[model samples]
Target: MTDTPDTLLDGTHTVLTPEYVEFRFTLAGIYSRFLAWLLDTLIVMVGTGAILSGLSMAMMVFPGFASALGFVIYFLVDWGYGIALETAWSGRTVGKRVMGLRVIQRSGVRIGFYHAALRNLARPVDRLPFLYLVGGVAALLSGSYQRLGDMLAGTIVVRERRLKAPSAIGAAAGEGLLADPLFVSRVKRLSAEARELVLSAALRREELRMEARLRLFSALGTKLQELLAMEKPAHLSDEKWTLLVAAALIPAPGARTSTGARAVA
Candidate 1:
């Protein structure tokens, strides 16, 4: 068990990745989690109402199949809903999005389909002894505020802070000529996901603590280094290298780009 840093406020935990980059995540407390869950339940109820109405119509027409169809609808609305939305929205259901919350892997990356499935599948177990009594206790006692499913699935819920400034490639300003055209090409070749990470790190750079910032950039820079197939210059901070990559990747004006760029398109 990792010790929670003294500097951290209550309900916050730090994750140190393999790249030695450490990030602080604020664990979603029971109150907020309950609120988010309540919102989701309401959504599920609405969906259930629609399904029930349809089922009622179907039953009147074909009474023999009513019970089975009703059961199927019940299962789907109760279970399938979360799985579908979380997977599709990258761990954000309608409720989570509204509440500014997200489910992510313990390591801080986005959760995969398998992770989503595993967590939701374990939902029944979490509800043991009624009203999430078992799960709530587990979360209250756990270091990372993990319920049984989250622990089993190696996932956690965290607060998703909205960036004050756009955390997009085009928002980053270039300094002088780019480091190398080859590097620029490499940056261009980066996967959309990787680029998003770089953009996010750059935009949120000012918000991170010094140690946390270094770790994050170091980790991201190392990954970028591998993609570029070269070592980063020692003098330039890891973050600077990441920013440089962002700048290089940003298509200049006359370029339509996402992340609030002035490009046409």
Candidate 2:
């Protein structure tokens, strides 16, 4: 099923999911990214400082003219440190980690060294025309918070929020529904195209026509209940099936009230 951000419920503040590409960076996300960046930067700075100090001391032991090498050593150290840190850790430098943000691929995947290098290398261009205007405009326009460098390199900067329990349940429940022995066997026996159609229908419920929706839901509900009765997973809670279905739809992290409203994280 090809899910899109438009399918998400309006005013529904759910946990971020792989299917939901539109990440809204909240206050907490900003703070977290900042924190992560700070931590990383401090580590890099200390390491660089120590290495440069040692190099300077070694250079002092050479002839007087050797002092001219200090500039070259300084430039090399700075360039190496910046590139290594940015590439190794994605777009996050020390500052970005402190802000709770990490650079990733647009598909919510980890970025590799090449993508990181491309974005970091373009940082100067992104800063042109005052106030990172180019980068800001790119981020605002992109589906994810991808700037010009990110677009060129196929990467994005996203807040690193922890997945909530409900989010996990949402992703797993789709598989759980088809896990029944009879259902599994039947699905497995179908042609690949038929199997895809059935699975797509189940996952992307909104795509079905209204009549189809009713028929599919009723039949699937009955079949699922019967299957559950045969060999229920011991760890499955006794919560109402309807509630679980609702929770699956409106997934939010952390515990909620009896009314199913989310509390503060």
Candidate 3:
């Protein structure tokens, strides 16, 4: 990770992979996070209001039960909102997506259900003393602008940024691997989902533990080898081979564009 004066000041979290590839992301500040939270809160209130309206209508028959049920529903909606969306949407909620923010683990990987739930579960404490006063102060104090929830969950909210494909991308893949017509053809035949997995693995390889890194790249490389109907090059390791393929199959900016006919894992 290269730490320049500007990068430090602006909260750029850069992760360097084993292959010396750098993944850089800008940390979301408290202001953007607050805006995102406000939007989510607004949405949740509308949804809860709709549910409460039905409960209010039923309250005529069983006022006590319906009133109690309404309270439960509000709590569930408020607490479940972030957990549900962040898990299903891969660290993005309606508000976060709209604001171009995503919650990811400290290692720069996507957050899963556990992280989402833990973070959201801590929300009540973060909201102590009204208007998220404690959370706001915590974020201001944190270099990465993490609130209590984020700190507890080992996650940080980041703003999505687009990176351009570099010219002469074949260097990482060894001398002339990308120039081989047969290899390029096989890469182009990989499905969109396969392309993404390969690239993500290659780019984030260093973030994973050694065992995980080996297993993942081995499985990925083997699958690609079978799909492409080519023997693994004897000189390259599994991880290196996978990185070569990823370098060949570059993801377009902000979208997954593909020119493939067959599906590959």
CA lDDT scores, all candidates in order:
0.73, 0.49, 0.75
2 versus 3: better lDDT goes to = 3
Score every model by TM-score.
0.74, 0.42, 0.66
lDDT of 1 by residue, 1-265 (tens): 2434422433775666565555566667787788888898888888877888966876889888888887677657868888998888778888887877788887667777888988888888998988888899999899888999999999998877644434433433544437467777777888856875676567656757788787788878788889889788777767777888877765666776654321100
Q: Runs in model 1 with CA error above 4 Å?
A: 1-10, 61-68, 165-172, 176-189, 203-222, 229-238, 248-265
The lowest-lDDT stretch of 10 consecutive residues in candidate 1 is 256-265
Error of 2 at 226 (Å): 26
lDDT of 2 by residue, 104-151 (tens): 555444566787677767766876796567876776565554568878
Ranking by lDDT: 3, 1, 2
Error of 1 at 87 (Å): 1.5
Across 152-216, the per-residue lDDT of candidate 3 in tens digits comes to: 99988887754333332345645478779999899889875577567666655655667767777
lDDT of 2 at 154: 79
Which candidate number would show the highest TM-score if scored against the true structure?
Answer: 1
Q: Comparing candidate 1 with candidate 2, which one achieves the higher lDDT? A: 1
Number of clashing pairs per prediction, in order:
1, 22, 0
Task: State each model's C-alpha RMSD to the native.
Answer: 6.0, 11.4, 7.5
Measured on C-alpha atoms, candidate 2 has an lDDT of 0.49
Evaluate model 3: give its lDDT.
0.75
CA shift of 73, model 3, Å: 1.7
